[model samples]
Target: MELKILKQDFSIGKLYDVSQADLQNEFCFFAKTDQENSLVCPTEFMPDDMIEREDGWRAFRIQGILDFSLIGILAEISSLLANHKIGIFVISTYNTDYILIKAENFERAVRVLADHGYEIIH
Candidate 1:
């Protein structure tokens, strides 16, 4: 398997339990109002209200194309984070996967990923 790491600075933003109505027209990096409401999107299209609640953002890597064969890869990552007591919000697209963690745990998460042999570009 091949993996690519990206280096980028992420802004940490305050997390809020925004109402569904409040997020209807707003774009957000990560939105989770309830157990079923977690949604992660790109930073550029996030709505103003979403940005208004900013506390901190996390830097993540968009690994190679996502496929059924990659489930093990994600599971491995999840296990790693879980063992460290870090929470992760994962978003998957047709092409790749994105992982989100709170800003407070960013460094530790990166180190963990790196220690597991994942190359980090940033």
Candidate 2:
């Protein structure tokens, strides 16, 4: 699969509450589990009242729409990155998956992936 890199740096935050705008962004991910409400968005969009946060993530979008029956695409990518000692954060939409990695490791991750024969669309 080809990966499309998103230029924006992102922040993941845990918030007590979120407005509808939080989930209606041009590009974002939000979820509420029993523990806390979580949101991932470009740094500029993060709210002021986050209970916790982690910053410096750059996103990569897996190109093309993914079918439900397709399996192991993420696992294969994750395993490759894992072997290179790079950590990742992942989110899936109904169509495709997004993978996030710390900005510091972005270049190396790209190189490793390129060497492994996965095409990256910048």
Query: Which numbered prediction scores highest in TM-score against the true structure?
Result: 2
Per-model TM against the reference: 0.61, 0.95
Cα-based lDDT for every prediction: 0.59, 0.89
RMSD of each: 5.6, 1.3
Candidate 1 residues lying further than 4 Å off, grouped into runs, are 1-45, 50-55
Cα shift from native, residue 71, model 1 (Å): 3.1
**Model 1 worst lDDT run, 10 consecutive residues:** 20-29
> For residues 14-70, what per-residue lDDT tens digits would candidate 2 score against the true structure?
887867327666778999888888999998888887788899999899999999999
Candidate 2 runs further than 4 Å off: none
Which residue pairs in model 2 clash with each other? none
Instruction: Tell how far residue 44 is off in model 2, in angstroms.
Output: 0.7
Considering every candidate listed, which one attains the maximal lDDT? 2
Model 1 compared with the native: what TM-score?
Answer: 0.61
